[model samples]
Each structure stands twice: as C-alpha cells, then as structure tokens.
Target: MNYRHAYHAGNPADVIKHAVLAFVIEHLLKKEAPIRIVDTHAGIGRYDLTSDAAERTGEWVEGIGRLWGKPLPAALEALVGPYLDVVARLNPDGRLRFYPGSPDIARLMTRPGDGITACELHPEDGASLAALYARDRRIKVIDRDGWLVPKAFLPPKERRGLVLIDPPFEERGDYDRLVEALGAGHRRWATGIFLLWYPVKDPVAVKRFHAMIAGLGLAKCLTVEAIWRPVDGERLAGAGLVIVNAPFTLAAACRAAERPLWEALGVANGRLGVTGDAA
Candidate 1:
C-alpha cells in the first residue's frame, strides 16, 4: 500500500519494462484478431513527470530524458521505437511532460477491438486509473488485490492476449507469490502470453527464482535482464523481465537492445544479458 510509482515512473526500470511491453504489444497486434491486455498492479495509467513527487526523485532525467529526440542505430531504434513514439504522441509540444504507464501504452497501441483490464490495489491509484479512462469503452479499471486477478481474469474471452503481472515488491515472499500466480494463470490459459517484471536487487534471489521458473518446464520462456549499476548489496538498480511465450522476434529484439540500452543510460562497469529461448 505504500508503493507509489509516480516517483519512479520513467526511471530506468520503467524505461526497460515499458519498452519491452510496447514491443510485445506491437508484435501481438500483427495477427488479425482482437486481444486483451490485463495489467495487475497498474498505477495511474499515465504520469506527470513535472509533479512534486517526480521532481523530488528526478529519476526520469536519467531514464527517458536521455532518449527523447535522439537518434539511434536503425536496428535498436526499431526495437524501442514503439515506446518512444507513444511518449512523443503524448508530448506534442516537443517536451517530455507526460509518460505512459503499461495501461496507457496498451491503450495507445491497441486497436478499437482490443480490450484492456487495468487493476490497482492502492485506493488512490486505482481511482486515478479509473478516472484516466472513464469514458473509454475499451478499458476497464478494477480496484482489487492484484495477486488474485490472474485467477479471476485469466483466459480472456478474446483467447489471444497478454497478462502482465508487474507487482510492487513491498512485502516479503513476492517471488514465491509470483511463481504461484503465474502457475495458476497458466493453468487457466495455457496459450496466453505472460509477462512478469521483477527488480534485480538480490542476485542470489534472482538466480533461485530463475531456477524455480525453469523447474516449471514452460515450453517457451525467456528472461531479459539489464543492469546499469554496480553490484551493490540488495540495492535495486537494474530490471528483469520473465516473458512467457515471447515471440522469437521479440526476444531477439530485446537482446539486441540489452547492450545498447545499457550504453544509452550512460554508464560503465554494468552488464546486460538475455537468457532462455523461444520458438
């Protein structure tokens, strides 16, 4: 209940997570059918970077702030272009004033036929989310425990959609809960796409989590990690995403950006890697 993403909305973690999300959504839209997007722990659908909380942290200054209006190698640009395009769409004045969260990204990229379910546990955040898309028939906002959303909303009627379970790790046992929630969701909708975003604070814990995920024997699971800081003790500086049923092109695209993104963030002695594979 204490975690508010406004302070960290466009930080490096968000940049990576939302970029990957946009890339996945782009790929998913290529097929000629409507899809659903469920975002557990969806914060305010969009953020104001100039807000008091955001200025207090100024995290975006080093994150998306470094990428706007910049040129990149065509290859890397193709990977991150969708996300940057969304930001540009919002800030038509040529200033980075607004940043889009996962729900907003989905709203921008998805077609009219697509449906989106945004869930937030925090009362205030949930109200904000609901208000953001109040008149938009394509989106539905739910104020419920995010952990329980998978079972309730899994196997979307569209039968082709993405389930993004990006929880705020404010409590203990989050990793275990993620594994359980993922399993339950998969059991309900085996063919659906699942994207799990996690912070890379404890290398040991991450290693164990990866092993446990591998132990699940998912047919096609990929892990992409970007580290932009030195190996500090239980300090969250980097981000990781466990993408189930990730398109091969999406995996390759993410891997292609891992190093470039690390460099773009303007840092050294940092590392990035993509493990696992999908067909």
Candidate 2:
C-alpha cells in the first residue's frame, strides 16, 4: 500500500475519524467489562507534526489545528473527551505537536485489563508502529493483512470489542474487500462493533457502499459522511465512516456535531448526515 497515514495524520479527515473513534470507544467504557480493540490497517502509532512528512503535507493546519481550543458542540464535546484527553496528554500545555494514529488511540483507551491488536501491511509503518507501542503489554502490533485476521480472531475472548477496518483505498478492490470483510466478520460475530472507513471520491462507490450496508440487514448499522468541499471531478475531497452495531447514543451526537465541525474547518458545503437507526 502506497498510502502512509503520516502525510494525512492530523488532517481534517483524521480529526473527524479519530474524534468519532474516541467517542465510540469511550462510550463503550461505561460498563465495567473489559474491552478489546482490533485495528486493521493501523498505521504508525503516533506522528510528530514537526516531522518532514507532516511538514510537507501540512494537512494538520486545516484539520485538528483549527479545532484545538475552540468550543465544540455539546454533543461532540461530551463524546470526545476521552479522545481529546489523550490528544491533550500527547501535547502538554495544550500544544499540538504529535498526532496519534488508531493504535495510539486504542492504547490510550485500553485500561490495564483491556487488550488491543493492531495490524499494518505497510512495512515501514508497521515497523514504526511496533517500535512506538513496544512497551505497552496490552497492545500487539502485527505486520500482516488485517482482512485475514478478523476471520482468524473473531469474538475476542473479552467478548466486548471493536474491529476497525481502515484500509488504504489506493486501489479499486478496496471497496469489495471492505464489504466482503464486513460480511464475513458480521457472520462470525454479529454483535462485535465494526467500523469501516472509506473515501468519498465517487458517488457511484458511495451509493454502492450504501446499498451494501442496506442489504446487510444489520439492525444497528450507521453511516456518517462529512465532506469538506464539493467533489472536484471524480476525486475525493471528503470521507465517510460506517459503523456496524454502533452505540445507542452515537448517531445523534454525530448529527449534532456536523455544524461546528464544518464551521471550524472553514470549508463550504461541508455536509454530514446519519443513515440507519437513530439510536
């Protein structure tokens, strides 16, 4: 995979994805039960915003940087505390220098008794991730195909868990892979939370993805899309996040968060919406 999350680590898209991810994971923490997180396509655990890769992209300036100290919508503010707190921990005195990837977020949320598994196919990122999170016993970093692992390790021993399928959509087969993986995973563990991230470049792919979700017959599947700008030709200018077996209260929070996120991003026609169960 040519996609290295370092280039886009702290971008607007990462802000939305990570914020929501933290929200959902925090919501899962209400119970006294232990939780496990499986992060497929997990990139480097953390990124230094000052690094050459991040400086070259400078996407964070348009993303998390804009929302740093601003007042967030109540829904988002409430749901994103755990995530923001970790982000805060990474930057003492409230300075944004390091941006945490999915694995970092998982490690942050996981308690002493919790467990985490991160899979990365990219060699460099995988190696970096292993090194970054090496000291955390609760976390396991693997250089392997994420799609295959879900089949091998379904219904985690902890029983309560989340599977994040964040593949690099650098190829056409990714959509099919997502659907196929979701279908197989759902069949294996219907109750396990599954999150799929995809780029919103072409309307055709978006519609097809929606149709796939609709046909899944999952009572609680939810889809959220946030577009920063109108599509330029057939290229993606935004992203979509789909959660199967989503939390009871997350949909409303996501809907309510749209306005502020769009406003903060300073982008026109920035749209966000919910599909599927209201709860």
Candidate 3:
C-alpha cells in the first residue's frame, strides 16, 4: 500500500503498458457486444504532469515527453493512435501536462453500455478515482484489495471484457500472488482477457514469474516485454505484460509499436519480445 503512481505516471513503462492496453481495447471494440473492464490497482483516474511528484522525477522526459508532438510511422501510429487520441483529448490545448491512467484509457475506449469497475486499495487514490467517475453511470469504483477483484468480480455479467491486474509489488510474494490470482480468475472466467503488468528490475525474478505462469498451461497466454536498458542493480530497466487469452492481432500490434517506442524513448539497446502460445 505504500506505492503511489503519481511519481511514475508517464514513465516509459506507462507508455508501453498503456499503448498495448489501448490496442487490446481497440480489438475488443471490433465486436458489437457490450464489454466490461476491471482495473485492479487502479490509480487516480488521471495525473497532472506538472504535479510535484512528476516534476521531481522528470521521468516523463524519457517517456511521453519524447512522443508528445512527433509524427509516428504508419505501423506505430496504428498501434498507439487510440492511446494518443485519449491523451490528446485530455490535453486539448496541445500541451502535455496531463496523463491518463489505465482506468482512464479504458473509460475513453469503451462505448455506451460498456462499463468499468476500478478497484483501488489506497484510500486517497480510491477516493480520487471515485470522484473522477462519480457522475458517469458506466463506471463503478470500488475500495478493496485489487487481488480480490478477480474472485469477486470475475465472469462479469457481460461475459466479455478485460481484467487488468497492476499491483504495486511493494510487498513480498506479490509475484506469487499474481500467479495465484490469475489461476483463480481463469478458473472463474476462462474466456475473459487478463492483462498483468509487472516491473522488470531483476531478470531472474522475471524468469521465475514467467515459468510459474507457463506452468499454469493456459492456452494463448503471451508475454510481451520491452527492455529499455540492461537489467543491472535495483533500478527498473523496463516493464512487461503477461496477457492471457490475448487476441490474435495483439502480437503484431505490439511488434509494430516497439521500434518507434524505443526510438522515441532514446533507448539504444531496447528489445521487444513476444513469448508463449501467442507468439
């Protein structure tokens, strides 16, 4: 509970994760059915790039700051357009002072009748999220443990949507909890799309986490990783997502976005990999 996203709101990790998330939501929208999105560990719905927290780290300079007004290649544009569109809408003045969190991205991409259930355990953040969507009938904000969301809200009545598990990972056994949560959630909603976000500070720990997920034997499970820098010491080099039951188009979309993302972020040794059945 000690983790707060305000400091890292628009970092490179957020850029990659949110870009992929937008693509996933875009694919889901192709179908005419109403969808539901559950954002576990949802931070405040949006962030101010000028806030003290963000300015202190200046991480956005290496992230969205680089892509703010640049033109993207055709392939990269197609993959990240929806996400950028949302960012644009939020910053109508053409300034990049605001950033949307995952829940905000989901809210922007969904259509009428579609809904989002955002659970935030942090009291202040939860209250902020609640107020952000308070007037919107389609959103339901919950103040609860994000890990418990799969068990409590899985197999949504709509039967089709995305479940985003993005924990703080401040506690020991968070990785283990993630695996267990996915297994339990899959058992309850076998067809639901599951997207898990994890930081890559240690290559060895990441490998172990992947092995545990692979042991789950879920079909169509895919691990998409963006390594911005070499994993050395305690610093976060990059981030990754383990997508369960990913859409067939997701792998290509991620591949298309990776090059431009790394180029814009100024990462000379960046690499993108898709592993598992979805590869």
lDDT tens readout by residue for model 3, 105-194: 999889989999999989999999999999999999999988898779998999999899999878748899999999999999998999
Give a tens-digit lDDT track for model 1, residues 133-250: 9999999899998889877998899999899999898875788888888889989998888999888888888888888898888988888888887657567868888988887887
Lowest summed lDDT window (length 10), candidate 1: 228-237
Deviation in Å, model 2, residue 174 alpha carbon: 0.6
What TM-score goes with each of the models?
0.97, 0.96, 0.97
Ranked candidates, highest lDDT first? 3, 1, 2
Per-model lDDT: 0.87, 0.83, 0.89
Question: What's every prediction's RMSD, in angstroms?
Answer: 1.1, 1.4, 1.2
Task: Summing lDDT over every window of 10 consecutive residues in candidate 3, give the lowest-scoring window.
Answer: 270-279
| Residue 130, model 1, lDDT | 91
On lDDT, the stronger of 2 and 3 is 3
Q: For residues 136-222, could you state the per-residue lDDT of candidate 2 as single tens digits?
A: 889888898998976888878998888999888888688888988898888988888898998888878778888977777778888
Runs in model 3 with CA error above 4 Å?
A: none
TM-score of candidate 2 versus the correct structure, residues matched by position:
0.96
The CA lDDT at 101 in model 3 is 97
